[model samples]
Target: MGRRSSNKQQGGGGSEVAPVRLHIDPERPAPRKLEPAITALRRGHVIVYPTDTGYAFGCAISSPRGIAMLRRLKNMGERDPKPLTMLVGSLADIGRYGHMGNAAFRIVRRLLPGPYTMVVRATSEVPRGMKNKRQEVGVRVPDHPVCALLGELLGEPLLTASVTHFEDEQFELQEPEEILRRHARELSVVVDVGPLWPDPSTVLRFLDDEMEVLREGKGPVPD
Candidate 1:
């Protein structure tokens, strides 16, 4: 569980507070131990947690302040072409946020819960700030248990930003303590599951029943 300390850093303007660190088993995350992180998310606070690809910065989907902080952290502008990705619990949640055709759905059903990011038309449910100029959004269903449980407990998709080293984009922050050392000022909580190497998710775009590979990474390209 997270410490009882305050976790209210907002849009890079608030006083710096020590981020609460919660260590949970990556293979079998206990819900009881996750309550504090859940509470922080409900309050629209940003968190750092492990994902199938790597660790990512996360916040509730409906948080404007959280979104602002995320964009600032990523050095992204208001009209940046790159859309933010969301972590969801299941395909059903993906459908709720994105418009996936039958063909796209079939492909996603097969490859998801792995390391893949599907770009699709966003539904009205998605916040405008999270979409790209094409009105598309990136969505993921990570195979990691901690990510799965976080989505399940939050009851909605979490807006995510990849945690990359500012000095070297190629380097990944593998340890929770290192993540805290660098980002404690901006985050509310850090969900630790030991070290994990970076392996970016494969990004694919689906439009008009056609599929296009945007960026190939960890996930294998489908035939």
Candidate 2:
């Protein structure tokens, strides 16, 4: 049986939802083991899952409730212009949400499925709330099986944000047990694979077929 916790929502009108921790083999996650998480996402609930860079908060891209919860969890204000990153199953998925010009496409094609976040112009499919003031969204194709599988099962991009310590922004939460303890009320599921050391993905922004390094981290910059 899954562990349970109870808490009250801020402002005292509702109860907090307890998150279920699901342990699965990181390398070979069985579909049966992933069903619960998929169900939670489908129901507009947020989840915590491992990615190639680190652990991240994820929900169905179309879930407004889930997106609101994510923004609240991240302490993003209504006017905050930062865009949330979406985890996609493949390069083809990226094209559906982001507009990549020929020059940018050629470069991005070689660096994906790794630790990198690419910011591109958003397509009509992306929700307006998910895009930055510049009309752009961040997208990632992580080189992690769980991420790929989740995207495939969800049948849409998983809107994601890095799971970092609120007090210490530099500190990332890696262990599922620890993550559940901290965010049990805000999440519906915690996908456990084991502990992964903190290393954030490199962020690159593309504008009119030009690439610019916004923040360099795990992924190396190309010449």
- By TM-score, how accurate is candidate 2? 0.91
Candidate 1: where are CA atoms >4 Å away?
1-16, 165-169
Segments of candidate 2 deviating more than 4 angstroms: 1-17, 165-173
Clashing pairs in 2: none
- Overall local distance difference test of candidate 1: 0.85
Cα RMSD (Å) per model? Answer: 2.8, 2.9
Write the residue-wise lDDT of candidate 1 on 138-217 in tens digits.
Answer: 99989999998998899888999888642355775488878776777788878888888978889999985799999888
CA lDDT scores, all candidates in order: 0.85, 0.83
- On a 0 to 100 scale, what is the lDDT of residue 38 in model 2? 94
Worst 10 residues of 1 by lDDT: 4-13
TM-score of each: 0.91, 0.91
